[model samples]
Target: MVSLTRISEYVAQTANIIGGVLELDVLIVDRSLRIIGDSDLASVSEEECIRKDSILAKVMAEKEQIILSSKEHNAGCASCLQRNLCMVEMIIGIPIFFESKILGSIGIIANTLYDKEKMINNQENYLKFIDRMIELLTNRLKEEQALEEISLLKKRMEVVLDSIDDFLVLVSRDGEILQTNLNFKNIFKRKKPKYLNEVLCADVVDQLLNDSEEVKFKEVKVNKIHDFLLSSKPVIVDQKDHGALLSFKSIKDVAVEMNELYTHSMDVVFDDLVGESPQINMVKERIKQIASSSSTVLIDGETGTGKEVIARLIHNTSTRSNAPFVAINCSAIPEDLMESELFGYEEGAFSGAKKGGKIGKFQLASGGTIFLDEIGEMALHLQSKLLRVLQERQVNKIGGLESTEVDVRILAATNKRLEDLVKQGRFREDLYYRLKVIPITSPPLRERKDDIRLLVDYFISYYASRIGKDINGISDNAMGILMEHPWKGNVRELRNVIEFSINMSTGDMITQTSLPFDLVHPTQEYDEDLNIEVVTQRLIEKALIKYGDSTIAKEMAAKSLGISVATLYRKMKELDLKNSIG
Candidate 1:
């Protein structure tokens, strides 16, 4: 007989293998007469096995071997209800027995009269062999089923561990690393280390393990950067310690939430910028080339393109790295107060001046760099003063008699086209030329789609650590969606999307369902944004209010908006603003 191997489904595989070796075709059925396994020839006569009055069913109900010899087939052929369709002249059905109970039945069909006499002569021997085969197959199937269940359980446990935000490590009693979650691997950026000390915070791990008392949730600084609470529990097997389960929480989050720290200053090394794209390499090379220069640099890109990050990199690599790098948003400050904020006011200089003269951003950044973000938004009068400061490398604080001699390098950034602003007489032409001495434009995220995968991994690791979730990675489908997105908000939008996904995800891997509603249904979000038509109408109303309500004023407003008078008139009519304008 042919050998039997384990099958995935709950069925006997031995019957078909045995049939292949013997001339007799075989069919195996369960208690309900469900055909579980059949030989090649038996497959053609499948209808014969499952019938209520079938030989296999009769054998199963009788719990004994039933043989239809040639004499029995010929003598009772007319009376048998299935005689017309029955092809076998002689057939034997043996009940499959396990632990004194009937499991099912296995049928063997003889092809010739000579074979039928051979089957009848060896009926007792066949019964004993069939009983042994059934017993062996039953035991084998039970073992395989148990193993399959255990495998599934282990998989489920791993998935649960991966979803946790904290660093989780399973270490043997001998201090060997057994397993670890993505959060732990992300910080070290390596595969699981053989030894615990090689990857974990050595000091924290040592303290937690060596401590005699329970040391759960003990706060410690890992690698002098991450503040984490270490928790360790002994995995007792048979009342003996088998291993340890180590988990950690980020105490840095608690510090921020409790208002113990207002801001965190992470060292922005060039290596921290994660991208291998040629565009990013070029930007890195440019930063290196101009790091030591004192010339004013103009950084330009859409919002969230990391303009401020590049500016900081320049300051960190410069000769004045030890000095302060002051940054100010030119547009964020009120127009009336921007001048005083940039150049400190003397005591009694304004209605509410400080008791002593305050050091302005220029004086504060002396011997260093002052980053002027949104510099294009500076008022015309302030631009002229700023131009003089850049030229002379000194600052004359507001309401101060003597000019304060300062040595500061100015680095300005803007999303607007300063050249267009200059042509429109909104920005000073001279100032634009001065700031663009060493211009660098940061590439938008969409332009660097090749880097999206790298960036996504970085963001997943970063936000997962921050929020204390155990997100290990993203699904392939989710990453594809991210790469395809236009990323209008650039890197900032990508970061937000990742953060949103990490929070919403219920599993270790960020799946499609974890994506934000707006991202999942982008058209709906687009339509929602399009519903802001009132913003455009409000802009037209403000322009008319500032100029005048007359046709002449409307012409001037249209010129400022870079649109023709007729277009403006048509838009006003379309927006139902014909009566509102004077």
Candidate 2:
């Protein structure tokens, strides 16, 4: 039986399409006697039911077709309570039926009284057209109901099999998959297959189907790293083999169960992140919210700002922390070899390919996190391929026929501005949206100057212990100089400065004298009133003091100052510093 709701939905869908076909307005009344669909954008509400004396109500009660023309109706119009109020010039309402039971009706209305008179004069042709349309709607409703039933049955079986312990798949005698569970789909990385060989190897299918004797359980390697115990048994129906039931249990899962006694520890924690700034704190909170979900993350920050460190921290705090963490630098790799390096290559993919083929960073990072640094450097052509892999959750190796499905989490970082790249048409806009699902920007050092003192003290102690120096702390003058520097290279540059000062220190405390010459004798703006020679002399003196007596250093200093080493040496000699250097 066709449901009233289903019949109403079919009417609404057909409303607009049928207007051009019949060149007349159409209205649908479902079994509930409610006006369901109207093509003319009519004033009547779809929720309203037909009144008892309306022409439509009488036709539905009588289970017959009624034609209303400009002229009076034969008998129905006499009894219709709405005859006075109904402005409809002409209408044809016919009862739709299924298995001899009245279901609903379709009504086609004429545009004007003249049109109504003309339609009534050629009533037979209009009836035939209306009858044909009703027949099509009835058949379509039956087909939709049948499909709905099949879908419900499939969902019920999936739920039942998914609750079972083992990974299960049912196949027909001809090696067609009859049913499979989510675990089976996830483990094999395949969907419902028409042929068993689509999900399993051809050899495995042939062996299982052809063997008449009891099939013994066997160990088989499914992917590169996982091994599973596979077994098949005949599904009997009335003493005849109908199909086979296949099941598997992974060896690694069993090992993990037994090793549950061992303690597992994460590689990173909130404490490992040094800064107490609000910006860093807010970032940590965001990581906590999104880390568990399997969404792609984009880390945006300048170079040497520890983007990879954020990636690692997110992975360590995630559920997949037990798995490996693999990283690839997109800008570091050569353009020609990038595809093969990222997606892997089959053996002999190219002349110098590795023997037995190599797994890509994506495949290696399965069940873990893969960090793609400098993702903005990926080429446009490769960006399209990467988008496909992310969409399908599968990778096709270079020179390889089969595609492998991966369960890896993606964490990408870039020093470049990707949105600007998108506007420049150098990056794929779709791929940009895909990677920035959870965008995080590491704070630059200049913006978070409050953390500088803590970072400086930490690095001083860190490098001091590493270099076996007795340096206990930084002097007030050295600390003052550090706070004033621009720190163009961020934290990484700060660490380098501390390391250099520690090596040059001659006392327990790091002082101004032990600092690099560039820091100790930093450049200062000269007075505008000074003469050209005075300004020139002052610039020469700073360079000579910074580079000292080293020829290579002086040469580099002179070149940076846009002068020749000979000129710098002459100036130093004129200043009476030549003998002081010797």
Candidate 3:
């Protein structure tokens, strides 16, 4: 569908040139026989449509040249509808061809007898001249088509570049700025720089242009002091370096991506802390009051008292909830590796450092919160570093030349008394005060005994559904035993006890026998008037009844009674109770 109208200006100029040189009028029509070019408009109207049976239409249909003379009464023009009105004495119509496909037809008409005689005498020369004009027109059309396709491709490329979130720039091998995307333009709020050195520092520009290989994740400042993670690759075409493509991603945005990748248990919200006691309610209120602030929090509690749970609740309700919540156990990691792990390290900083270096927990938790569990166990030297980081809101990586600014909220938890550690010179006093900007205490389960029933129900429902059991409730005797036992391990221990009971139960309810052996037969308290011999005899009888008389059963009984198998056998023989075995 390459139409002659697309190059109408060229076609018109060529028609006029032919008319001036040969003293003959010319007309050019497209594939549909629509008149698009005319040299002498006085003879044929510019909008005239050629008749299908005309000599020019016949030439186009046959894809060949046709010559007719008025005096010869040519049969080709005999069928023309306007034969009487035709003013031509002689004419030559030739089909314009490109790549074996006819695009249109060009008609050269001789109106006067002098012109007609001139054309007839030099017929071979005239045909050759017109064929050359057709060649020029086809070449012009090809150039126009190429320009059209290039324009379309450029528009598509712009759309793709604008959709990217990162700032993008295209540079030449000489470091001249060739192009930039919309993000780059918006950030700088000005026209693109003429050269890479105009925006990036000289050293960065040198690395980008001369590297010949891709540069990845190089932290650099652009337009003076804006931090970015810059990546660049040389643009190569046909084994020759053309230029390079540079992409700059904002460091804050990168932090969010890393947070999403590493942070876990994102669903731990305030409601997940299941408790309803005066102490627990007061703690909840305090969390709600202070969650909006960015001050450091020190949570003090015994083991299994849900200190980490309170920290997560505070974080989930804070302004940084949408960001990361990184948790690290200070005691779990070795003292040798704690510094590098918390603050990160650069390439070659140590004997076994990663090639590209590593981002620290603080950087990953930027615009978020970081929880340090068992902070009292951190080394004294590390405590000094941690205090400096808290004071300055910055982190100096291992072997790094400069410190990086961070915007992370610190939350440290310890079961031990940090004050006593400071008194003993085991922990830094200044660091201890710095960490406790806001102090929180997680109450043990013994203090919140009223929540025991609710916690038990919650755990039973949770573990029953997970283990696919049909447990309904605990028997009154079992409940009394749980309530009277001192929960030294707190809520975590209670949850474990409930899970154990559900697994051990065969019926819908958790009876006394369904509980663990230790829970069912706790050691009794003796008074001053109690007889030690009588008490020992009754304990042995009860143990034998509960456990069978087999060897394994006796071993279990002896273990439960806090004695060895031989000691239990000697005591039974001395007490004359050997006949008691079933």
| Top candidate (lDDT) | 3
TM-score of each: 0.47, 0.47, 0.76
* Deviation in Å, model 1, residue 165 alpha carbon: 43
Q: Write the per-residue lDDT of candidate 1 for residues 1-582, one digit (tens) a residue.
A: 111224413344577665765556778887767777777633323343376767788787888977777535444455678766766767778887655677788888887777677778887877777777677777876676678789889888888888987888888877787888878777766444688676457655565456423455554445445646677787778877667888877643332332223212733779666688888888899989987788899998888999988888888898867666778899899999888878877656888875534556676566677899998889999999999998887777778877767778899999876775775688999989999999998888888889888889999999999999999999988888887788999989999999999999999999999998778767833444555667677778777755555668789988887789998888899999977753
Ordered list by lDDT, greatest first: 3, 2, 1
lDDT of 3: 0.85
The sequence of per-residue lDDT tens digits that candidate 2 reaches over residues 131-176 is 8777777788788788989999988878988987778878888988
lDDT of each: 0.76, 0.76, 0.85
Hey, what RMSD does candidate 1 come out at? 25.0
For model 2, name the residue pairs that clash: none
* Model 1: residues with Cα > 4 Å off, grouped in runs: 1-266, 524-582
At residue 319, give the lDDT of candidate 1: 87
Answer with 1 or 3, whichever has the higher lDDT.
3
lDDT of 3 by residue, 500-525 (tens): 99999999998898888987787656
Residue 541 in candidate 3, Cα distance off native in Å: 34
